[model samples]
Target chain A: MPPTAALSIRDLKFRYPPGADDAPAESGEGVGGWIVDIPAFDLARGEQALLTAGSGAGKSTLLSLIAGLLDPDPSHGAGTIEVAGTNLLALHGAARDLFRGRSIGMIFQTFNLLHGFSALENVMAALMFSAIPPREHRARALALLERLGIARPNADPDRLSVGQQQRVAVARAVACGPALVLADEPTASLDPENSANAMDLIQSVCRESGAALLCVSHDPSMAERFTRRVGLRELSAAPAAVGG
Target chain B: MAMTDFQIVVRSLTARRFSTVTTIITVAVAVALMLTLLGMKDAARRAFDRGSGNMHLVVSRDASPLVAILNSVFYANPPRAPLSYAQFRQLRDELPVEWAIPTQQGDSFRGLPVTATEPEFFTRLRPDPDREWRFAVGRVFRADFEVVVGAGAARQTGLRVGDQIYVTHGTGTVAALAESAGARVGEGAAIAHIHKEFPFTIVGILEPTGGPHDRVLFVNLHSSWIMHAHDRRLASDPSVKTTGAADVTDADRLITAVLLRLLTRPGQDVTAVEPVVFDQLRRAGGFTVAKPAQEIQRLFAIVGGIHQIFVGMAGVVLLSSGIAIMLALHNSMEQRRRQIAVLRVLGASRGRVFGLMVTESAVIGLLGALAGVGVAVVGQQVVASIMRGQLGLVIEPTVVPAILLGVVAATVALAAVAGLVPGVMAYRTSVLRSLKPLG
Candidate 1:
């Protein structure tokens, strides 16, 4: 663990509960065996780290934990989970949502955008969730979308190509000016050219916000683009073989 | 998302305008029926309450309760039987009469008249409690042939004091006296004999009593005797040339029916007694006498029962309407589940959501209740207009507290009941259900 890292995880442990007598994630691993033990990892500011994992390699689980959607400890599960000085897990029910809104941004591997909202609206909603004064939200959101190369600000996310949807997702992720941005397979659905465009937009925005970017994917081309890459198998137990 | 409760409810209601309007109309019909019947009942109650005995009519059971009271007391219908003048006097002495003035009705004059009643009919029996008899234009009647006029009678007939209104035969006519040579003799000459249509003065004009006496002309019972004395001595009076007052006076002993108020109970009074008692004691024929309250109470009971039944039926109708509203809300919930979940994620508390739906129903109830009251008032006016024209019933419309409370309570209760289904649905919704995409 580096002292200069924006986020440092040391022996960060978790399990689903009652069913797991021993840590489900332990690979006969470190001191005090536990599931989901992150022996070590560091994401310095302004750096993008790609996670490479095959199916069932805990890529999504890691993304969820980092996003604060899941808890790290059973007893203190309801309390805020801190990143930098802000706590996403402990912000009380509604305020946790608000803190996530203001401090952390997420892009799903599925590219989940509210179906009813336009690309601009999808992005604008993210900014509105932040503690920023409402009057400043629209202007800030439009500027963020355009900067992310979302050419059509008023188009519905569906009307846009996959590339455009990815850009809109990126626009939403950075619209709040978050300190941490988590993108799970951010350009997985895009063609090679649009994927390049999407990747360029995400990388530049993370650098500008000085937000530590943790992007997960098993694609060779995408994983090598990150400042540091990690394999999920290096952390979790061996992937279960089907028909076991 | 930041909207106040009222604003949200208004938006939601407007969004489902058809459903909301249906709910309100349902409540309106239910409440309107209850309000209208209750209003009519209130009016009828006031009429019975104000018109009952409170003041009573003491009558002989000629036919119906309505008939007997109307005829005897209004003096508009003919008396059933004649109780002799002597008999009337005897009973008046016996009964604990506040005032017992006899009436002789059923004999009208086209212009000339004969009233076979005591002078007290004009003096004491005119129903007004205040303003005892005083002549508006002239002195009160003094002689048997003299007369006193009610205010309306004087106005319509145009006969003033000293205007000799000739007496007429009791045959209800206006022809000059042609049977003059019979048993009866005129005091003066042809001028005095207008049959029983003799000349008499209008000695008094009675102030209005809002009673039958208001249109009557009053005269002493003796005047009727002199006019009808021909009928009494028919054996001799049929041949006018031989007829005389001796035959008329000696043969006639009876007069018209007596109007009596009891002075004392039958077992208690002294001397020879009066033959008729209008109120309590048995009359000339031991007729069935009814206390006005008992008769009136029964009438009110029938009317009020019908009224209560209508209101109760209205309550059932309202209950159905409430169920309709509850179903509408329940049906909409499947669609609304996601929206509510969104609101939960966006920070609406469980209590707030519950309160919001309840408040919407309350608004509907308030509006329906107000509309029902307005409808009731208009309905009352319509009934009153009809009654005034056709029935001569002056029913005062009343707003009884119980009726108002019942209508208002029904509206609110129905709405509150309607809200319950939706409130529970909203309360049980979860964050996972809301945050997840719809199927």
Candidate 2:
């Protein structure tokens, strides 16, 4: 099966703040910030992979790239890329959105559940964006939350503990049962006890959904649970290579 | 996105309770104002048209509007310069007229009978030719001594049939006519036969025409002639002779004005010759001529102008409300940008995303306008009592659908403007960044 690469990235480079010297005399966004460069990256289906690098290494970029967040790596300096048999490089704006909506589920390091919705509402809202039938949304959302061990559907994250919020976020990602789940620092805020619960809940949910997992984190200890571990340096070059 | 669109809209509105209600109420108030103004205009038009029922010509060399309306049409006051009865007779023989019931005024019940004339003087003065009036009770005046009471006269005086009352010999009396119990026409005032000194019975009552006829008392032409003949009747008989009916033998006798009639044809019938003939007759009779239809059109213009003023005022209100909707929509754009971005990334097409914002705005505006009309209807009804009672202005809250159409169309258009801004904003944001955490 050639390891079923769920996401394949080619050489990509980008300038973050549009241009270096375009900043005017003094409205102060502090002149220029940084740049990101990447050679190649790939993630296989149903496999668990971890990304470890320092703070500014763009570890998050790799997850964004695999999840189809950033545009299809426009530089073409790398090579052809594929995800789940669909060529990522050959998609346009609308097609890319549909492709991502159907094939990828993303979990941010920080839980970005809507402030206006309850935990169940937040999960249900994610289902709304999909092409799923509206009548089927409730059942799919509740079942996914139940599988991830969300005991109460009405609880908003503000009322929940840090570990519980991550469960809701994870539940949302796999709510529609996608082919791949990408998490960025899923257990970063947890203590030892909460961390273990979050890791178990997220990894188990992704596996149960039959999705490959790509979790990005700087902490090396979190790698023990995954089948594979690769540093930003090992993927390509240090500092010059960016994952986010 | 489907027929469930309304359901989604309703649920979405209910979900955000206060904002939805306020917006709806705003639109409703505007519609209400427009509706009320339209209804009032209809009422005013009805009243004016009624007051000027066709009495087309006032015959004079030159007559003012007040003189033409009152003396010639209404028969309220006597003509200032009375041509000899011989002159009125001469004109009648010459003109082509539908009908002219000669009229006399300026006498009173004690204080009320400012109108003095024969009963048939009004028979030919039909307001609506199809529906002529007759007495509702008692009998019409048959003798010189008998008097027929109009509905207004009956109601105001508490008068009935078989009652005897006398007219006070004066104009514009200050005291109540009934206060003088002996000679004053009181509760028992009856229809008297003209040309007689003896009392007769009040035979019948006229139907309410919502006009000046309501205030009249009827007598035969002989009664006024007999009153004028009082000087000749003194030695002949101390008691006035009561002739129950007109001395049909004297149909060709003297009258203060002439009564004439010409045949009227139905449908597309132009009586252009009548006006010219009427003009020649007025010149021959030493008077002037006026056409009732032309006079009615003039009245209508005045009424129409007043209605236009009110509608214009309501339009101003509608305009401000439209501007208000636009402002509200524009203000919501920045806050709604994230929502738009999220919808687009959710596989919503650009048009679909734009449509949502626009639809919401339209919903708000349309609801408001419809609600405004409802408010106006109830408001008009509330004030209807005062309107009818004080000014005789009938205010009917007619359900005019065209007005509602205007409200819906105008408000929806405004709401679209509201939606346009946010849609553009959503179209501009980066979909990828919208999914990103706000760092």
Candidate 3:
């Protein structure tokens, strides 16, 4: 009867095949050789969580599964990954892509803004796939960039400072007004001062947009800023956590 | 502002400006060369068709029918065997001919072929079936030593109505004739033997007929006979006076060829009687007979092989350009994998990404094809000018819009086909692998 969770996972399990390019070096023998074994996880609407893990821990892989960039082999793993109460595992490739573009926003570790695009265009790129009217895309992107403290919306992303580039990435991530936003080491490339600023900026923007946040990072300091914190080892439920 | 897929493609190309521009130029040069060859071939066919006129057959003393048609109709060279006036008269009286016009072409005026014929040559013959020869400035020549210049001849020689110019004994420029005479160009007396004693006054200039005749100078047959007679007398007796038209005798009356228009039944085409008259002339031993229209077709048939070779070479160039487009896009795929992944994350489907790549190639082709049309137009004019100056063949260089459209469409389609390989590479890109951080 309560509002549906933005993200829900139940009895989910995933493991790369042995000798696969991205297979973990030390596979867990527990639960039939599974790499990632989680009993249950959920993020309520408008909730914020920081997922902390070691360097090889599968924090980014979890984000990839949630974003539908990779599929969990149904034969090897079983469970449901639901976004906004819609089962992501039930959707096909293109349908999943559309759902991800409309319902989820993702921020990468390296501030991967398209090189040739200006600050404004990078933000607008996300809006291109949204249900927003084409006539309003420009105005909405500009408003988001301006609100994010981007002084030169027309400047190339490559020429912007590290902090400014992170801001552009943040603007691009939330441009579609998604239900949940995923941040994968979004401040890893910034120095201490800039990292704090970038973290604050990402959380503030997500909260303003009324979206839940699921951020992955190895930094212990990021834990103080989130309302909820879960370590990858505890979430995996298996004896050994899956290393990427 | 929001960018469309096309705008993104354009920006991507501009980002790698050097490769894009080079690829477009390669395509443009190939397209232009192909279009130019097509234009020249079409122009050459039209020129030959128009030059053949409405005449049914040509009677000359050339070695073959093609040579006879070329020497007699196109003035390509002087005839090797002279058809005497007596033989021409005999044929005129013996064959089923409506009109027999004797033509002499042993001389030239400043490199323009000088054709000596009766006044009927202008009034009777049509350069094309529906077009009549009309004077651009003045009337046709009325007397011996009076001449009518063709439009191209006047333009090239700067000859005007009422200008008197000496006719040379051979088809060479004045400097070449003087050199052959063992004299410098300015040595008037030393070069005198190469020119007629009397000068011909240009009385009219014919309008452009879009044929080889546009580069000729027309004179009366009597004028040629008198000039030759005077030259012969000067060689024997240097003090002999210049001969006039009245001095032209049977011995001096020699013609290179005779253009024949066969007599046909009422409402019948001239081709109906052409074979019959052609056979009679062939059976007779004195004359060489040629069907002008048939010989022109034969000439093109022999030349068509060379044209196909040129077209094949242009096609190879065009194919290479297509490969260049493919290679350019394919080589960039390695660097663009991450960009493709980013677009995929931004919600672009595999089909959309593939289409964008193909559209990029098509856009490049469209641009290059349009630019090639421009280049072809300029190239055609340059080729036409050279043919006119060197061969005295008036080629009407025209760009057929249908051909242009077909070439452009084909080029774009070729380029789009070329893009399929790179498009597949993009479609199959692994979003997660590409988005992973590089070590």
lDDT of each: 0.59, 0.60, 0.83
Candidate 3 reaches a DockQ of: 0.47
User: Best DockQ goes to which candidate?
Assistant: 3
Top candidate (TM-score):
3
User: What DockQ does every candidate get?
Assistant: 0.06, 0.20, 0.47
Model 1 CAPRI rating: incorrect
lDDT of 1 by residue, B93-167 (tens): 766565555556544544323345676655554353333555577655677667877665676678777766654
- Which wins on DockQ, candidate 1 or candidate 2? 2
| Model 1, residue A120: C-alpha shift (Å) | 16
Model 2 chain B: lowest-lDDT 10 consecutive positions: B186-195
Deviation from native of the Cα of residue B198 in model 1, angstroms: 19
lDDT of 3 by residue, A117-200 (tens): 899988888888888988999999999999999999999988889899999999999999988899988877888899999999
* Model 3 alpha-carbon drift over 4 Å, by segment: A1-3, A18-33, A238-244, B172-193, B265-269
Interface RMSD of each: 7.2, 5.7, 2.6
